[model samples]
Target: MREDFLLLNPGPVPLAREVRTAMSEPMVSHRSAEFESVYERAQNSLDYIFERSSLDGTKTTSGGTSLVFNGTATMAMEAAVANLAGEGDEVVTVVNGKFGRRFKRIADRYANVTPVEFDWGHPVEPEAVAEAVSDDTKVVTMVHNETSTGLLNPVAEVGEIAEEHDAYFVVDGVTSLGGDEFLVDEWNVDVAVTDAQKCLAAPPGTSAMYATPRAQEAFDGEKAPFYEDLDWHLRKAESHQTPFTSAVPLFRGLAVAVENIEEEGMQERISRHRSQSRAFRAAFMAMGLSMFPEKNDESEYSNTLTAISLPAGVRENPDAFFDAVTDRSVSISGGQAHLGGEIFRVSNMGNLSSEQILRGVRAIGEAFHEAGEDVDLEAGMAAAREQLR
Candidate 1:
């Protein structure tokens, strides 16, 4: 692998130098005061991210607690459902992509799941969600950004439906929280989850969630998994710690990562992500590639990752195209599940510079050429350059 290989996959994005350096600091005991201070620093920064993640300064949330756990966002996804819903309770899950389906599967384990399904790569309809949720529903779960198809779901619209029905609203903001606009309280989100590896640009193995007072009032400790009881997690958070032995190094990395976000400022970071994503889409279009997802009035393209359908030539031999990309010292992702070989996804998350985004466009264009496709490399580069400007 090249020393300067670039990562354009959706999660586990390239980390900042400071974040990488912080993770290598001498190992500290989880119970030590030093570690507690580290946890406090991370928690405070995360609070800033959660509250001030809006693209504009018009939206902000307060009076909620942020909890960090020793697992990825999937664990938090389960905790959100387990602690709020039980057997016989109905959970309305809006499924448009892989992550949304995962929420339904998790909800199925603890509650009766009612899925408002849509074809992958298609936007979710708020009217469908409104029809699915009712007063009898105990929970409503949605994925804010469906990374698989590069589509952003309508969280605020669905959140209003959940709020109207008086159900606990749990949103998987795994890919959107730090990179895009997420108005938690404004959207009536009771529990919102995100990962360190994704938008936070930290190392993998840690995740965090924000729980509103309403979620706290509805929490049931016994129903939650032994290792994922939010009630116990909340108690431990008061002292700036976790209920179990935490990943100290990852927390250190996360602290530095969120502090980096703070220094960059949420508005500037969000704008960068948006601009990069636009550049990616523009480049792909100029190369004659079509986007994978279809947008609607309520939902639109993801501002962190872009998914493009493969050209006929490349789709016939996707591995060769991907190999060409890797040969260029760049790594992008193929589609997941049934969409495999049909589409490729690239991420604009993390602290990537404009130069890297342009390089990614050039790499993809060159790879397509290598795969015997007729993509206009110069046109793609020019389109991307214009957007980056």
Candidate 2:
């Protein structure tokens, strides 16, 4: 297949040349000494990203051991819960969007679930979480960034609430860990999951999770489903290995991606993502497109993706809205679940530059016009330029 369109979807984002080259190298043996070096390097990167100095499993709250699963972020999310929340234990889930709802679904299968749901496009309030947790609540699961609605939840505030209640906090940080600012230890995140495809700027084959020592207490001799078990993963990860045969190529790609992230510096990478998101938001607002989320302030906005409603005429024909934009060689995303066809999501993650964002805004403007919506392309571009500057 020939690649042509500019991929602006959240995960499986456009990869860096170095990461691609690393993946393109010859196949490697997962058991070889060479692979062990690669595995350690990746673990070191994960450590830095999780804000831990080591993974020696010494500290109760900050023992930063990360497990890389040979599956998608969904698998890691399940592991984080399955390993902690067992039968008879109550689990609290914050459902503000699709991904948050997924935590409730997964938790339902393993334990008693108490869902604290919010409006689809609104952020989860800390007070609501405080009200949900109790003595029987074993886990409190939340999404750091609700990718479905482009709403950033109050992770820190909720983390503190969980701590006060002595409930384990499991966070789905897939879209925020690398692109946005996150501190597993500082935020009291007991278990957090992230993917290689989203902000990590790599292909999707493996996902990683950070588990603190206190979280390890959830193990009750009974384990989760075979492949998703964190006990088996931690046992193998001690030797810089996985329980099953791993995808060596994706590991190589991820290692390089982590190196590139280190070179760019975490703060610089976060600032870049923020700038890109600001530019995209400014352009959309200038073109008279309101965000799907009704935000009173910027605190609830996601820096990785923006969910914007289509213009009046364009909303009448959702397919035409998508087709017109794809016809211009730009690949953004439509909303998911109940939000389907109502809003479009634009991701500013991975290796995207200012020029690509400008082009994307232009393509969207063209698509709006093509769909018979009267849009001010010049005004949108000007607003974007101001933010980018």
Q: Which candidate ranks first by TM-score, i.e. highest?
A: 1
How well does each candidate superpose onto the true structure, as a TM-score? 0.98, 0.95
Model 2 whole-model lDDT (C-alpha atoms): 0.85
After superposing candidate 2 on the true structure, give the runs of residues whose Cα lies further than 4 Å from its correct spot: 1-4, 52-62
In order, what lDDT does every prediction score? 0.92, 0.85
Those runs of model 1 whose alpha carbons end farther than 4 Å from true positions after fitting are 294-299
Clashing pairs in 2: none
lDDT (10s digit) by residue, model 1, range 320-388: 999999999999999999999999999999899999999999999999999999899899999999999
Tens-place lDDT digits, model 2, residues 130-171:
898887778899999999999998988988888888899999
Candidate 1 whole-model C-alpha lDDT, 0 to 1: 0.92
Kindly provide the TM-score of model 2 when superposed on the true structure, using C-alpha atoms.
Answer: 0.95
